[model samples]
Target: MQTPRDFTELSMISKTRWQDEELQYFQHALSQILPYINSEGLTILHEINKEIYTRAEKQDSQYT
Candidate 1:
């Protein structure tokens, strides 16, 4: 189970730039804790996923 502090940290982290490795770490962490989190956490998870997808799109565009 994740603590409220964990969610707070994640929320703060979500607002900043992330290296690919760090993003992957949090992505996995969030998925693992999904079943245990509240609706607010779910919202944060969606935000993280959106960030990941957005970054991927940017990287892909650079290669095109």
Candidate 2:
């Protein structure tokens, strides 16, 4: 029988897996249109890039 903790961990793992799959799908879609984004999409992509850069900096700081 699964304990409550086991169920919670499994739920989190499932959510993470779903998120990773979605991210991959979006990445592949983006790769198809290599340099032809509209203005609004460009803005959104810029925000995403900024967020990724910020998170990478935070992770680097943690390791340093």
Give the winner by lDDT: 1
Among residues 3 or more apart in sequence or in different chains, the pairs in candidate 2 whose N, CA or C atoms overlap within 3 Å are: none
For 1-64, candidate 2 gives per-residue lDDT tens digits of: 2222332353345322333334344445555774897886565445445555566688799999
lDDT of 1 by residue, 1-64 (tens): 3223444455566444655665566678879999999998787778778888988899899999
TM-score of each: 0.70, 0.51
Give the candidate number with the greatest TM-score.
1
> How many steric overlaps are in each model, in order?
0, 0
Candidate 2 vs. true structure, TM-score: 0.51
RMSD of every candidate to native, in Å, equals 5.1, 10.3
- What C-alpha lDDT, on a 0 to 100 scale, does residue 7 get in candidate 2? 29
Local accuracy by lDDT, each model: 0.70, 0.49
Backbone clash pairs in model 2 (N, Cα, C under 3 Å; residues 3+ apart or in different chains), count: 0
